[model samples]
Target: MTPIVRDFRPDDAEAVAAVRRAALPFMVTTPEGIAFEVDQASPAARYRLLVAEEDGEVTGTARVGLAHQSPTPGQAFVNAYVHPGHRGRGAGSLIVTTAEAYLAGEGAAQVYSWVLDEPHFRTFAERRGYRPSRPAHFLRLDLSNGELPPLEEPPAGYELRAAADFADDPRPLFEAEAECTADEPSDIAAELDDYEDWLADTWSHPDLDRDLTMVAVADGKVVAFSAARTDGHTRYASGMTGTLRTHRGRGLARLVKNHSLHRARAAGCTEAFTGNDADNGPMLAVNKWFGYDICATEVRHVRELG
Candidate 1:
């Protein structure tokens, strides 16, 4: 059966999530999360979730969008995934072809995607003119059976709090996140200055478990945070973990993450996952100390739109 690509419909949420789970088991994917992403995307982003169907079954999916928050204009991205059982078909090729044309029409001059660091995946991207860039690793921890570090007390003048504590106002968390994100190592430079968008897209995300997210406050200010996303069952993933520049080297990142992991485990979460850029040694070391093992690696690939 020939596969055809089309824009994702609301009813395709579950199928899309299933495809993602089959292609990347380390990360958490939920139907509600998929719907939320499509519904909450900013207009500037031109976000489009594309699905490849064969005999009325969703066999592949791709997330196509412009880097709206990037300072550099004309930067775009498309990450495509084909179900393991459906590979070797033309679904991946068709999805990328459709996404590239759409992005080019949207005035994008460059596009980036993440290809799994496997010979077949690398060959597929290379055949399509995508050149390898930086690489990242997906790490997993067995929250149910692994030994997590004991929670430590925050330093003298610092205290730990739940993200839910800021229910009335989450601006402090946003401030810390913006600061940390701007410093993160990435192929695309993002400027996270829109608080309203952040509130809608992140703070209110369906998967964000405020109760499990731990924050480190110093001098009554949010200095570090470990954001947690859960599947409401057994899977928990670290959305982001960062410390303010002023608080670096103080072990605050570790402190908050440890607390969040313990909370997740107590809440019945059996597994935890996170990703880190290969260039980010500090974060990799931190995850290593927490007993996380590298489960998979993906290399970023980019191509000129001309």
Candidate 2:
């Protein structure tokens, strides 16, 4: 039977997460996180999660939407992945076609995707008119076996805390996240001007491990943070690790992340993973210091959808 592509249902969350795990094992996601993403997306995002089914079995999934945080207009993305065993079944093509059509209808003039850095993957994207742009690396650490850096006390006047400490008022953390995000290297500049949106899309995310997310406070201000996400099983991932501009030279980024890693290991996490843009040298160096090895690479591909 020919594969049929349709909007993802609440029941499809687990299957979609399964497909995501099979396609990109280094990235951590949960079934509830999948549903949260769809439900919390802003209307301007035009988010749609689509699934491709064959014989009543889900074989692929796609997430397509406008880049709502990007200040640039007409920027969008469609990332589609087919399970390794389900490749060559035309599901990828059908999902991409539907995703592009949806983005175009939302007034997107350009769509970007991340293609696995392999010969066939590159060829497939090029065949569909997507041209390669920036490259990124997926790094992995064996939290179960590898020795994590021992936790150390923060510098004078700096205290280590978890995100949970800010449960009553997280505006300070939100402000820090926005400032650090704006300074991070990226193809599309992100603007986090909406505090309420950030609260819905990130702070309250089901996958965010508030206890494992470490922060560095100096002068009672959120200066550095290591955002952590877990699958509630064995996998732990760094959602983002950054320090305020004024705190960069103080090694606060390393301090918070190291503390968080120790917390994760103590909590029984067996694996850790993170992604880095090729040009982000500082963060890459930090990951390397933690003994993370490059497990895979993906090249950003952009297509003008005039």
**Top lDDT prediction, candidate number:** 1
- Ten contiguous residues with the weakest lDDT in model 1: 143-152
Give all TM-scores, in the order shown. Answer: 0.99, 0.99
Q: With candidate 1 superimposed using the best TM-score fit, by how many Å does residue 250's alpha carbon deviate from the native? A: 0.7
Candidate 2, 1-306: lDDT as tens digits = 799999999999999999999999989989999999999998889999999999999999999999989999999999999999999989999999999998998999999999999998999999999999999999999998898887789999999999999999999989999999999887788999999999999999999999999999999999999999999989999999999998898888889999999999999999999999999999999999899999999999999997
Candidate 1 ranges with C-alpha deviation above 4 Å: none
Candidate 1 lDDT, 140-246, residue by residue in tens: 99998999999899999999999999999999999999999999999999999999999999999999999999999988899999999999999999999999999
Cα-based lDDT at residue 29, candidate 1: 94
- Write down the lDDT of every candidate, Cα atoms only: 0.97, 0.94
Against the true structure, candidate 1 reaches a TM-score of: 0.99
Error of 2 at 58 (Å): 0.5
